[model samples]
Target: MNELVLPNDTNALNNLMGGRLLHWMDIAASISAQKHCNRIAATASVDNVSFKQPIKLGDVVTIKAKVSRTFHSSLEVRLVVWTENISTGAKAKSNEAFYTFVSLDENGKVMRIPELIPETEEEMQLFDGALRRRQLRLILAGKMKPDDATELKALFFPEI
Candidate 1:
């Protein structure tokens, strides 16, 4: 997804507003999730988002998103945002985020989706780390006990 950072998308400092950027990222991540499952997906959660660089008004912002991993009914989408200078045609990464989406049926019930088979080395790394990240998220949300996070526990206590 590509967006022009117009005045409406910027704050008083003439940089893109964080909220507006988040909205754009959600749309982009949702599109990737929907395309993967071929079903309507609802955002379940969004990880912390940090802007690495200020995107000024008139800059072109490009967002690239892909499914990092999939659980039974939910998938994680990784998104990278870049800002381009129109005149110089230079582009630099500005932000990155992870979004979780749950596929839904017409009745709005959660539906199972196909799994992701990561082929590349980068993909394999992300796929392997997804479980630890998910466990941490669940633990932080109070949905799972820290002791139950086997993958995460191993990181801190390798003997166990």
Candidate 2:
């Protein structure tokens, strides 16, 4: 997904507003999740998003997204945002985030999603790390017991 940072999308400093960038990321991530599942998907959660650099007005923003992992009815989509200067053609990474989406049927009920098959080494690494991230998210959300996060526990207590 590509977007032009117009005047309305910027803040007082003439830089793209964080909320506007987040809206674009959500669209890009939702599309990736829907494409992978071939069904309507709703955003379940968004991981922390930190802006590394400011994107000025008239800059072109490109968002690349891919499904990193899939569970029973949810999938994690990784989004990378880059900003390019239209005149100089200079490009720099602006933001990166992970969004979780759940597939839904026409009745708005959650539906099963297809499994993700990681082929490359990097993909395999991301696939492996997704579980630990998910566990941490669940614990933070109070949906899972901290003691039950075996993968996360191993990171802090290697002997256990």
Candidate 3:
């Protein structure tokens, strides 16, 4: 997903606000998750978000997201943000984040989702990284008293 950085997305100094950028990232992540789940996937949580560069008005903000991992009915999406200067056409990395989504059926209940098929090495790497992040999130949430990464890993991954 992409958006042209406009005045409304900026602050008093005309720089893009982190909140607005994060909102867009969530939208992008949801889009990617929904594409895979084919249902309503709501944001269950967001992991760390790091901004590496600042984007200004007139920059073409590009957000890329893909399903990195999944658990019973939850999906973790990895999002990368980039910006291209409208005039100079130079692109720079902006930020990155991980979003967790819970796929819901028409009754608004969590439903089973198809297994993620990692087609390439990049995807496999992303899936592995997302698994680590998911574990960290679970640990932070106090869901893992034993602090076992494998226990947390089992939550979002299927035995192949």
Candidate 4:
């Protein structure tokens, strides 16, 4: 997704507001998920979004998102945010985020999705990283107990 920065998105300090940036990120993420699933997908969660740079007004914002990992009924989407200064045309990395999306059927229940096909080594690496990140998020959110965490660690990080 690409957007031209406007004055309305700026705050009193003339910097872009975090809320607006997040809203855009969500939109882009959802679109990417839908494109991957080829079906209706809902935003399940967002984890560990960090803004590394400040975006000022008149900076062109570009968001790139892709499916990082897929589970039985969910997928993880990783997004990278970038900004380009209109005057200087210099591009800078702004932020990155990981989001979970759950696919739904006509009745709005969780549905199974096709198996992910990773064509490149980088895609395989992304899948591994996203799985690790998802497990970390689950542990932090209390979704995984200590035993469960230990089991996952054994499965994914035995070398550690």
Cα lDDT of all candidates, in order? 0.95, 0.95, 0.87, 0.86
Alpha-carbon runs more than 4 Å astray in model 1: none
Candidate 3 weakest ten by summed lDDT? 151-160
Q: In terms of lDDT, which candidate is stronger, 3 or 4?
A: 3
Instruction: Give TM-scores for every candidate, taking all chains together and pairing residue i with residue i.
Output: 0.97, 0.98, 0.90, 0.91
Clashing residue pairs, backbone N/CA/C < 3 A, model 1:
none
User: Where does candidate 1 have its weakest 10-residue lDDT segment?
Assistant: 44-53
Q: Tens-digit lDDT track for model 4 on 5-98? A: 7899988988889999889999998998888778889998998777787899889999998898898888998899999998998999999989
Residue 59, candidate 2: Cα error in Å is 0.6
Count clashing residue pairs in model 1. Answer: 0
Cα lDDT of model 1 by residue, 65-141, tens digit: 99999999999999999999999999899998889999999999999999899999999999988899899889889
Lowest lDDT block of 10, candidate 2: 122-131
Task: For candidate 3, write residues 1-160 as lDDT tens digits.
Answer: 8899899999888889889998999999999999999889999999888878788988999999989888889999988899999789899998888899999999999998778988899998887777677778888898865447874556667581
Runs of candidate 2 with Cα error greater than 4 angstroms are none
Candidate 2, 71-155: lDDT as tens digits? 9999999999999999999999999999999999999999999989999998899898999999998998999999999999999
- Per-model tally of clashing residue pairs: 0, 0, 2, 0
* True-structure Cα RMSD, model 1: 0.8
Candidate 3 displacement at residue 128 in angstroms: 2.0
Per-model C-alpha RMSD = 0.8, 0.7, 4.4, 2.1
